[model samples]
Target: MIRLRYATMPSNGGSRTSTGTIQTPPTPMADTSTEPEVQLRMFSQPRFLAAVRALVGTMAQRLGFTEMQCGQISLAVDEALCNVITHGYERRPDGQLWINFWALEGEPTGLKIVIEDLATQVDPDDIQPRDLDDIRPGGLGVHIIREVMDEVNWERRSPKGMRLTMIKRLQPGRNSELKNE
Candidate 1:
């Protein structure tokens, strides 16, 4: 199990457009996969962002994700996790974020990532397309996620919290090679 926590620095307050004191404590998430594939876990925190990128890069390489594809996945994961850290937890620093990654064996679209966070609900309809012409530092996370992942979906759980699912399908030629073996 991968566990990590993040503490917000006073100077960096509001830099990420989050309110309240965020304390993302490390929580252990279960990894029940017998198959060798992608898997990772990190609580809502700023420092863990880099770790997420590294984990994704390693997983992508193992899954035969091309450099470009790997980069896209990394960026997408970052955005998703960031959302959890910022809006999900509202930078309250009192919650945890759980993430899971796996490669769909014997299929062309051989990879999938599920990010589960005990944060506030985010309406899928509220997500709007970003305008490239407008230069801004914020509001690009959702857009980047959608662009990078082949499939993006969200669901709300009872009581509270939300789950974001992202999927990517490899090209047909790559899928064939993976299937033959």
Candidate 2:
């Protein structure tokens, strides 16, 4: 099971411009306590994918994840974002997507990433990867994310949104491949 403590969004709430850029970073988000969580709100535009991936990759690296594991985590995050943009938002550009990155603590140290989208709400049970036998040009994102992450959970957010939680734990026997300078 994956357990993580996340921070509450600022009381004032936050807003994003039409271009999907935040006018100001929210307060109470950079809690550097034990949990150390970061929340990012952006549009489902393809142009923001690189920045999001870089954020996830850097966080994974700092959390003592191996180089390959970091890549896997980043890939999983990318796929999740793409899935939200494509399937959830139906290729819409203005849809808002929020991602929360949590640094876990305890016996199995790891990272937890939550991708929440306020696009189209669907039953979590209905979301799954297509049959591999069909051999399609796409539709492997769910498969890849499930394979890479240690724990994955999906839920329909209250009102109108979907939440995807992914967690990856560092193996006890393996040491971190990257170190802080």
Candidate 3:
């Protein structure tokens, strides 16, 4: 089973809070029929983003994500990558963007994506939804990500960095064998 535990940090002047810890259970000794899952990580770059999009599409399709769902995830991911590249890395172009996608085993049909960057930290409490009435070109990425993903989580890593984790649940009745934790 996978568990998430929220934690508070006192190392950085008590100004930051972590979303949760991700814990995965050890593999079963009896059930050795299934293959191991894979994870992907990349740095901040145009080529990396393109590869991420393709990988998302392929995985979503294989997991039976609807066309709309795939598109929504793609857009949200793009926005997230852009934010990491621009705001997080301060447009350094040479910064790194780490991305990890994994199938949530023994769950109610779900997938999890984790994006981490060693850039300036963004306080989750500081992010506020923009007003719709006020026409503006900026400050819409966070809103869009929240709308598209089933669950969105943000946290600062110790000294310097931020990690964004997003989860999407697939349609019910497709994977009944797995149990939710």
Question: Against the true structure, whose TM-score is highest?
Answer: 2
Q: Worst 10-residue stretch by lDDT in candidate 3? A: 23-32
Misplaced by over 4 Å in model 1 are: 1-39, 175-181
Better of 2 and 3 by lDDT: 2
Q: Which stretches of candidate 3 lie over 4 Å from their true place?
A: 1-36, 174-181
The RMSD of every model to the true structure, in order and in angstroms, is 11.8, 8.1, 13.0
State the lDDT of candidate 3 residue by residue for 1-181, as single tens digits.
Answer: 1122233348766644343344332222111343224344455666566667776776666676777888888878888988888888887866765566666656567677777677899788886667778897887888899998899988886667787888888877664232323
Error of 3 at 37 (Å): 3.4
Write down the TM-score of every candidate.
0.73, 0.78, 0.71
* Tens-digit lDDT track of model 2 for 98-161: 7777777776888888787777888878878888898969889988999999999888776677
lDDT of 1 by residue, 65-87 (tens): 78898888999999888888888
Per-model clash counts, in order, read 2, 0, 2
